[model samples]
Target: MTFAISKTASQIAPFRVMKILAQAKALQAQGRDIIHMEIGEPDFASPSCVHQAAQNAAEQGLTHYTATLGLPALREKLAQFYDGFYHAKVNAEQLVITPGSSSALQLVLTAILNPGEQVLMADPTYPCNRQFVHLLHGEVYSVPVTADSQYQLTLDHLKQHWNPQIKAVMVASPANPTGTLIEQAELLKMAQFLAQRDTYFIVDEIYQGLVYERPAESILAHQNLPQNVVVINSFSKFFGMTGWRLGWCVVPEHLIDVLDRLGQNLYLSAPTLSQYGALAVLESDALTELEQRRQIFQQRRNRLYAAMQSAGFTLKTLPQGAFYLYWDVSEYTQDSERFCAALLQQTGVAITPGTDFGKEAGKSHVRLAYTNDRIEEAVQRIQGFVEQYR
Candidate 1:
């Protein structure tokens, strides 16, 4: 007998970058020299303080399952972090620790969305957001945002796309691929508008600490935030703790009990050792080191932006935050998927095709992460590839 897979499983698109990464790894196994710019993981290890804390936790046998909500101390530390960093008064009760921002997002959507409900977001987003919506049997309404609006959904855009079906509006600040941020005033206006309509507003602040030229602001910074407003953040990007897989979300007080119940069933709790380790991440010395690393990332962004332009790649927006450069490769190829695959095979440089984000405007684009130490080498390889292919 034959069995049928779930429709949701069928609708999920494969992460094309991972496929390129696999090929790159295969080439590397064959002794090929590959410069990776495809994946968005930071190359740095967790700070020494965090590593020490993890070691101590292990020695002390703090490996047992923490409370479903989280270790009380870690939750309190995160709550205080918001007050100190963003000037937002987030009580410990408002925070939920999840395995990662990915899982946090899933739990948030699961807690809020019913079947056939919809969430509106910009096209060419982080890719997983739409997939999570699909997994929950909800619809994703992707608004096509351009560089003019900094690839962000404006209040006017939200108004234009407003319908009873749109249950929530999700956006990433210093957004993935584009690395553009929504101004605080615009965010406030959106909050007010959504509040008036009783619609949910979810901001993905995964890259908050990675912003440049402007201070990182949290949606929680707004004292009058709508009851439905939620913020998701992770240690993966800024703290260089990707493998630790720990992240937290700030939810409305009313949904705390619901999420508590959901968290109980999720993974029991985020990794206990990681939580203990993350406690040291917010220390003054660790933050100073992290700030220095941020400067390095900013420099890499500058170097790549200039190099990509010199290589004849069209860049519409300069990245202000995060460590990604999204380029319009229309001059080279209309099919970004083919362009990426061929570039990897020929030059041994792996990059992400924009098609992985969305098919609309993403067809003529590619996203390169500046997370590697060999930015100059990657630049040279890309320039040579463009000279040959274009």
Candidate 2:
């Protein structure tokens, strides 16, 4: 039987990363022996304490449904996290936990945008942000970012694209794929400017704790009261719990009730076990485990930086935050997707094409995920691939 689908759903294509990943996986299944860098996932498993917490939760029959707003304990702990990291206090009443940050984004877009409204974001950033806009029947106004600006969004660019139909501005710090962050000064300027109008401001902080050189700042640190920022965070990155489908958002007090209703209808509540596990992340000794991993990622980031530079590709920016390297391959090849695919086939190396992030700058770029838990082997394989290309 032919199944029915929404008109909006029919118009959009599948997430490009997953499509490429599926092709790469299929090739590997044929004994291709691909060295995976195409997908963005942590190499480490969830920290042992987190796993133990999940076990305890399941054994306690915490499997029963929780408040749509999230378990009270988890919410309180996340509030403390805001105060600690961002140096800003958030009430638990402002929080709503959802299946994943991805789903949280959908509700934020749906809650605010009228059909045909515009949602603004940087083009050379996350692909899924654009997809979320489309899924909500909204248009995207891409703010073009350049390597000179560290590929981060600026307040000036915000003004260039802002319009009457635009309802919100979506930005990610330590942004996905690019791994670039919006500077705190620029972030404040953008927040203050948006406050001049009725526009909503949403900040995605999924990569908050992954920074290497400098700590990634949160919008909560600087935004004014009545909390104009709808801040999002996830357990997937820092907790090494990507498979857990857990995330939280802090809305304006007025927005929380609406978000809770949406959470109940859409998610029911983030997986019960993951919620209990993330409680440990927010409230317990999880920070020590996270810090240990951070040191390792910092070293891998340095290793990948040197390797890419010596390999003859340009070092546009050596990612100040997040675990990615978005650099130019234009001097070597124009078709990044084909270059990546051929490299994966020939050298057993898989890196994501720039186009997977955005169509404008993507033609000449590729993103290298330095997610090597056993990084030496990944680095050596990359070094070998570079020599062969010579």
Candidate 3:
């Protein structure tokens, strides 16, 4: 019996890292000591306070559905967080909490895009960014960016690619695969450019709190930001709440009703217990714990940067934030997916092939997520694997 699938489902690309991770898991089951560096989840657990909050909520039987937009208290807490942290005047009415940043992105895209319209994005970004557009029957126009631009889209790139068909421009800062950020000034410039044209601007700030050298600011914090702009953020990264599956989006006030309806239909609400736990995550103690964990991630980034360099791989751009190091492995192999497969099979170590991020220029690269506790051991195994190829 043949089952018919929608064209959207058929066109979506697979996340190649999961395939590598599955193979690594199979090897581990066979008594192999596989050191994982493929996935982008933190090794740390959620803060104790968060866990306790969830437990307490469960004990009180607060496990039912929340308001479609979110619990009023959670939305208020998030609004306060943005105002206190960044001085961004965010009102609770503009916030819509979702199961994760992924869904927040989906809501924004679905709310703004009409079928066959184009959305501009940087190439070599999070693969799902484009796929989400495809799921809505929207076209993705990828502007190829390089290390010089920190793998971020530039004003000139936008000017070159901007067309009448384009409806939105989406970007991720402290971007995935590269972990580089768009400078605040450049972001403001892009915001102004889009504002003048009345084009929609979407900024993914999921890695905001994890920045190392400089702080990553949200576009919503930009004064006089375009009314069409939307900001996507999550509790999964710095807050160490990956399994909680909680995140929120800041959209124009006018879209709140539309988004509320979409949220009602799509998820009804975010997880009730997670919302309660996230309230504790905003407490002073949780912030301190998260900052300490961030320092550890920075240490891992420094160690991995050094290790990959010593192993004859050059990073195109040094990672300034997030827990990933994207490497240029052209000298060792042009086919990164093949290189990753051989490395994992030979050394029991896993890294994400750059091909998982993008096709152009991505084939010569790979992404190593420093989310493991055994970074030194993974480094050693990686070095040994590189020696065989050299």
Q: How would you order the candidates by TM-score, starting with the best?
A: 1, 3, 2
> Which parts of model 2 have CA positions greater than 4 angstroms off?
1-4, 223-226, 373-390
Model 1 residue pairs with clashes: none
User: What TM-score do all the candidates reach, one by one?
Assistant: 0.97, 0.94, 0.97
Candidate 2's residue-wise lDDT over 1-390, tens digit each?
989998888878566667678877888899887767766878888877778998999898889888988889998888888888778878888878888888888888888888899988887868888888888888898877888777877887877778888889988888888888888777878877886878888988898889887775777776364346788888888778899989888788878878877877886877889899888777777788788888888888887877666555568787877788887877667898887777777667778888878878888888888885444566577666656445
Candidate 2 has its poorest 10 consecutive residues by lDDT at 372-381
lDDT of 3 by residue, 282-310 (tens): 85467878888989998889888887677
Model 3 spans with C-alpha error above 4 angstroms: none
Quote the positional error of residue 13 for candidate 3 in Å.
1.4
**lDDT score of model 1?**
0.88
Question: What is candidate 1's lDDT per residue for 1-390, written digit by digit as tens?
Answer: 969898879988888888989999999999999998988988888898988998999999888999988889988999888988899899998899999899899999999898899999998899999999999999999999888898889999988998888888999998998898988888888877887877888989999989987777887888777787899999999888999999989999988898889989878889999998888887537988888989999989988888877766678999899898888888878899888888889889999999988778888899999988787788788788877654
Worst 10 residues of 3 by lDDT: 307-316
lDDT of 3 at 158: 82
